[model samples]
Target: MNIQTVGVIGAGVMGIGVAQNLAQTDHQVILIDISEDILDKAKYEIRNNIRLQSFFQKSDNRKTPDSILEKIDFSTSYKLLENADFVVENVTEKWDIKKGIYPQLDAICPQHCVFAANTSAIPITRLASLTKRPDQVLGIHFMNPVPMKPMVEMIRGYHTSETTIEIAKQMLSQMGKECVIVNDSPGFVSNRVLMLTINEAVFLLQDQVATAEDVDKIFKGCFGHKMGPLETADLIGLDTILFSIEVLYENFNDSKYRPCPLLKKMVDAGLYGRKNGQGFFVYQ
Candidate 1:
């Protein structure tokens, strides 16, 4: 099915990026959140992001930021999603919050609407089980900066059909992204390893192995990585990193996945990384 109108749940960092990217592709976007205040903040951020992105990438499509923003409808009501052809849910990674959303989305969206869970560590199969249309639910893990990223990690739940996979691929194609399809698992391929690395990085910092700057420098200067694991954790949000690692620990019942105490302390301190201007390293 052709997905022209898309519903985006949550107004957080990932959700705003997804909505912005969809609007740039000329898709009508229904961006839903729990409150008007959050939606209002999301609108402001999307507008700013569009302007900033224009400075970095030149595109043949000359739609101005205002015109792109016009394509998105920010609302607090789930009822507004009734006509959405596709829905990508980017809510918090916690299972309790997500389990409460999928069933509601199933009730509101069209039967053909595919639900894409843009999550970090939660198992797609577990999420799919909450909805009656398990075959239509899959995972589309869009990278941090949705518009700038060229690839996504797509998770195929045990019940997700091939047709659903094709539809997801088609939607990603429209957004100028390619997908690497992988089997459903807690953390999948990317976060399964990434969370461990970030947790270890935190442990290193707690152990005084090196400064955050030097640690990131080694990965960038010596390992040829764009950013070190600590920097990545900061970008992903320290709280988010901690939650993902905890999920992995519980799911695998392993000590290695245990979160560093310092990571937990920082999260408790409300230093959520770039979003809040503080984390492993403070942002300007």
Candidate 2:
């Protein structure tokens, strides 16, 4: 289906970015957050993402970013989502919370509106089953820093229809993202492999094999990696990194996929990479 209006549930980092991108493409975007405070914060984030792309950077293009920001309609009310042609649910990683929104989305959205989850690792099939229109539900996983990231991982669940998959690709491509299709699995591909590498880096730090900075340096210095695991985990959110590692471990039952204690402690303490001002390096 041709997507003219987009509904975004949750106005967190990922949600706003998704809204911003769609809005830039001139799609009327409804960005919903349950709490007014969270919705307010998301509005701030969307503005920043737009400013950085439009005016802050010397090398960045300005046109599309401003237009994208202009197209968004931020709200705390779920009723605003009714007219959307596509719904991009980007709530927190908790399964129950994500599951709760789908049925509600199903009730409100147009019967043919595409349901796309911006989930990083959860099996889409489980989430899809909760909705009435399972055939149209699919995963459209955008990487972190959505405005800057170029890739969008399109994950198809066990029962995802061919039409849903095609529409997902078309929507993301229309917004200028590189869409790669992957089966519903833990961490899909890039994140799964990257999690292992990051977990190993964490292991080295915990085992006293290297300092966090050096752990990052070794990979960048010798392994041709531009961003090391710890640095990456920080940017990806230590909470997200830990959760992805856990999912990978649980899915594979592999010792190597186990998350580091340091990772857990940081997340538990609420230090989420750049967002928290501390993960590996100080952000501020």
Candidate 3:
């Protein structure tokens, strides 16, 4: 099916990026959140991000920020999603919060509307079970800064139909993204390895092995990685990293996935990395 009108759940960092990217592609977007205040904040962020992208990328063919913003309808009502042909959920990674949204989405979205879970560590199959259209539910794990990223991790749940996979691929392609298909698993490929690395990085900081800057420098200078695991954790948000680690630990029953105490402490203090103001390192 041709997906022209898309629904994006959550108005957080990822959701705003997704909605912005879709609008730039000329697709109509309904961005839904729980409150008008959050939606208002999202609108302001998207406008700024679009302007920044234009300045940094210097692309002559890109749409104006005003035109792009016009394509998105930010609302607090789920009823706005009634006509959405596709829905990509980017809510918090906690299972309890996520479980509550799917059933509502199933009731509200059209039968043919595909549900893509843009999650970090949750099992797509488990999320699919909550909806009657298991075959229509899959995972489309877009990386941070969705517009700048060129690739995504497309996860196929146990009952996700091949047709659903094709539709997701088509939509991603429309957004100028390529995807690598992978089977369902907690954390999938990206976070399964990434969260462990970030957790270990936190442990190293906790052990005073090196300062956060030194640790990130070693990864960038010596390992040829663009960003160190600690910096990455900061970019992903400390709270999100902690939650992903907890999910992996519980799912695998592995000690290695246990979240570092320092990570938990920071999150409890409300230093949620770039989103807030501080985490492993402070942001301007």
Give the candidate number with the greatest lDDT: 3
Better of 1 and 2 by lDDT: 1
**What ranking emerges by TM-score with the best candidate at the front?**
3, 1, 2
The Cα error of candidate 1 at residue 164, in Å, is 0.1
* Residue 82 miss distance in model 3 (angstroms): 1.2
* Clash counts for the predictions, in order: 0, 2, 0
- What RMSD, rounded to one decimal, does every model reach? 0.9, 2.1, 0.8
Which regions of candidate 1 fall more than 4 Å away from where they truly are?
none
Superposed Cα deviation of residue 240, candidate 1 (Å): 1.0
Residues 1-284, candidate 3, lDDT per residue (tens digit)? 88899999999999999999999998999999999999999999999998888877976687887899999999988998889899999999999999999999999999989999999999999999999999999999999899999999999999999999999999999999999999999999999999988898889999999999999999999989988998898888988898899999999998889889999999999989889878888889
Q: Estimate candidate 2's alpha-carbon lDDT, on a 0 to 1 scale.
A: 0.82
Better of 2 and 3 by lDDT: 3
Q: Estimate each model's TM-score.
A: 0.98, 0.92, 0.99
- Top-down lDDT ranking: 3, 1, 2
**Error of model 1, residue 17, in angstroms:** 0.6
Give residue 99's lDDT in candidate 1 (0 to 100).
92
TM-score attained by model 2: 0.92
lDDT by residue for model 1 over 71-148, one digit each (tens)?
Answer: 999998899889988999999878888999998999989889999999998999999999999999999999988999
What is the Å distance of residue 151 in model 3 from its true position?
A: 0.4
Off by over 4 Å in 3: none
